[model samples]
Target: MAPSSNLLNTQIDDIVKTVLEDATGDVYMVNPSRDAIEDFVSVATADDDDLPTVHMLADERTLKDVMDDFIVASNAADLIDAGRLELRTIEEAPENSLLVTDDAVVAIVHAADRVGGLVADDEEFVSATVETYAGRWDDAEPFSLRTPPITRVRNTLSEEISPEAEDDFTTILGSLETARGDGDGLDEVTISLLFAARNEALLYDISKWGEDVGIASKATFSRTKTKLEDMGLIDTEKVPIDVGRPRLRLKIGDERLADADNGQLATVAQSMLN
Candidate 1:
């Protein structure tokens, strides 16, 4: 296959901006990175009611930085905030690069080193790619409520717990569990909630953790979150984004849990259980 003479002269970023700006109904992308999606995010969030719904599919390794960039872009008011944007991870590497809007297939990123691939409006290729994208979208998890990355949490725990004794280690974990527990016990729902807050996940993700743990249904996640709030175990703060209302971020409310040291278990248990 031969490259388009026109694409040889075009810059990658410019092509991305053009594709995103030209989108009307929806946007479908495969194997996108932070730099690849920057312009698309800007164009998608520009309008309030009319923003195109975006669905991105990529390998698990790339999802973290993509999510980080989305967070930053949403904060900067460059994308729609009403959950219009969604992401999913695929186990297999994409066979071909694709960027599709409702109207056309704007770009294909074939090789990592190449500046660009075929950029065209071939009717057959666009139709086939769009069909492929729809299947991937249906199977992807909701990034808003997706599990917090294990690597991020591991890094945090490693920094805090190194050079510690067995007793101190027990105390740190015990304190966290006690803070999330009530007079009854630390059930799965409670434990899951604590895990999310300890990792400083957003409220959306915390609720999903409940569902992931089989807490009756998705609605129960919200009820569980409210229960935690009422118990003074967790707190929420609104972070402004591009559209609708600001997103709520979850945090551990108890100082005993935050401190995570000797005597923390007793301190939190007394307040939380009593």
Candidate 2:
């Protein structure tokens, strides 16, 4: 018999509600960002003393932006950290966002946009999805190593050195931006700037000085900086630039970049940013 489309839609809706609304059991997800996943967990386990253990397998490319979002928002960080959420990164991302209970009684696979997908209890489908997840799990790496170094308390700035330096750096940035079409333009620009830099730390501070040198905006530069930091392609340290306050220095990933040749480093940069 042909099933009623209306009935099927209702059932699917119910399944999604159950998976997101219920405040019991573990939750697992695959997403490029924390967009809806965070809310899913928060709503699922609200008011419970023992919250569900949440596990996320996300794309490595989005790891920096994700971490930056968490760092910028204290509430999000608190919720995830308090829930003891375990995070890992995979180079390839899933086509949909997944939410599975520990008991495997309910599994919801939403779209990458977090808008829709199947929410089912079918044992075979659930089992198959779990198996695919296991494979991804093997390829994933811990999120801790990819987290940004800066904290909320640390007052960081990207103050451009001087008017003379800005003019020279602006010209350099324009030339490098010509390579933008091949990969992540901002990211490639950031990497190229750091790579071609003679100084150990490039003072092209994103927050404070990016606009002066043709960077689109503070947010754009900050995001690129975070991604570089997360990929272990860059590092941040507070240098005592004056008597009053030390400035945050963004430099190349010395441990990796030190021994690497320009060609080799550029290849890696392209791989990461592209």
Candidate 3:
């Protein structure tokens, strides 16, 4: 296919912007296929550029993609080594090519300003460092992954948060991302009090979740329970064993939220700090 001069120019502009004030040496740009990475790494260091560098990566999370990417990179190793490609240039770039630096995030916000991406949408898990690389299309579904809203705290939670709780929230999200559904996740008071109220997913008349995980009040607990209900992650009518009245029993959603989570995980993994 003929290169779309317009599209190519725009992408080049974006990539160049990524090489801000860092000490100039060599830089490498990579897309998320192992074959592309290997191919790039092979000829990459020798290619004419303002910088001499090798960027190596192919995001094949699945066994098959991994194998394919590895094959090409390995085959081309001789080419890369001969070029004296700077190891720094060869830093791993996941196929997503996501780079999440404060600068990158700001750039994304600025470019997407027209799209109303301005809303406070950073996940607790996403650092100020922000970068995005193209996601590989799945051979099966041909879909790209994304960081979902639930994982990120709205700007409302950004302020007055203790560093400790912030750390707490971040850790929980990390676990939640990998913890497979028992097909049976629970929204206990601990979840309702901290993440819900703090992240503004739920607004209780009173939110002291950061202080107590057990949750001492019934009235306030009920309010947040309803909030989770609105989100559809929990059922309000379960549990006859311990309560005279129907108590809100927390539960995970079937697939929608889970899919959302996976998307976000992809973004986070891709955006990891090198």
Candidate 4:
């Protein structure tokens, strides 16, 4: 959201993409500056708790520089193609250049865990690491210091989530909406409808809930409604609009279950504007 005169319009889909691309950070803010957006994306993805391996890769050169140049190859791709990076023989590795094999380079790079300093002479380290991996014992299972990496948080959510939960949630939301359209149907009609809404609206109620789930009684609906009202996830009002009248009417919230019906997205949006 920006000043009407800004003329820079971005879609919610684009904002969501930014959130996914840079997960777990600020999704929206007052100003959508480029630097701010990038920083938000970076920080959202960055783990503050995973502190820098202070002593892990600390060496003559900072790990950032080594990882940046050697590991990530951040140099200009065109310049690299031009052989701008010349291989000057370091005192460490003479006969065996560090650039011997990609696998060898990886082995040497990983050996930092076994080393003392944060950074080491790249030339010598690469050659030694290569030589270490080539020995016959590399095939030995126990000799391998490297274990499978700790699964990153990204991996867990990456698994294909069974759409069952999604569908069930959708169904619950749909039921709430259908009930809203079915306003004032039966005297206690709102009771069953609101119950369905509670069963699926908030994640807690619906997390373990399954589709075609059991129906809720008016009493159960009361409990769930209180919870929903407390969270402000939904609004329920029992009021007598006309003066001196004692009739109870139920009005739904802005976030009704009908919001998820994709076919009516445009229709809903149009209604909202009106």
My TM-score estimates for the predictions, one after another, are 0.43, 0.40, 0.22, 0.19
Clashes of 1: 1
The pairs that clash in candidate 4 are 57-118, 58-118, 58-119, 59-118, 59-119
Q: What digit string (tens of lDDT, one per residue) describes model 4 on residues 1-274?
A: 1111211233332332322333221111211222222332233334334211100111112222222221112121212233221111111222211112221121111132221101122556645654553442233222111111112111221232234433433333333322222221111123323333433333223322211132234455556556545644346434444676443222334464345353343234234333
Candidate 1 lDDT at 16 equals: 60
Candidate 2 lDDT (Cα, whole model)? 0.49
lDDT of 1 by residue, 189-264 (tens): 4544555565666666545443443232557666777888888887778888898788777677787666754455
Best-to-worst ranking by lDDT: 1, 2, 3, 4
- Once fitted onto the true fold, the runs of candidate 3 whose alpha carbons sit more than 4 angstroms away are 1-24, 34-158, 176-194, 197-227, 230-274
Task: Give the candidate number with the greatest TM-score.
Answer: 1
**Position 201, candidate 1: lDDT:** 60
Cα deviation of 71, candidate 3, in Å:
28
lDDT of 2 by residue, 14-117 (tens): 44345534525555667634545435433433435455566677775565554433222233344554654666787766555566653343333443433433
Q: What do the candidate models score in CA lDDT, each in turn? A: 0.55, 0.49, 0.33, 0.28
Q: Identify the runs in model 2 with alpha carbons over 4 angstroms from their true place.
A: 1-24, 32-34, 37-49, 70-73, 76-83, 102-114, 145-274
Candidate 3 lDDT over residue span 189-208, tens digit each: 33434333333332322244
Clashes of 3: 16
Pairwise lDDT winner, candidates 3 and 4 = 3
The residue pairs in collision within model 1 are 45-79
Candidate 1 least-lDDT 10 residues: 69-78
- Among all windows of 10 consecutive residues in model 4, the one with the lowest summed lDDT is 51-60
* Stretches of candidate 1 exceeding 4 Å from the true structure: 1-6, 43-51, 69-73, 76-80, 110-114, 145-274
The 10 consecutive residues of candidate 2 with the worst lDDT sum are 1-10
Q: TM-score order of candidates, best first?
A: 1, 2, 3, 4
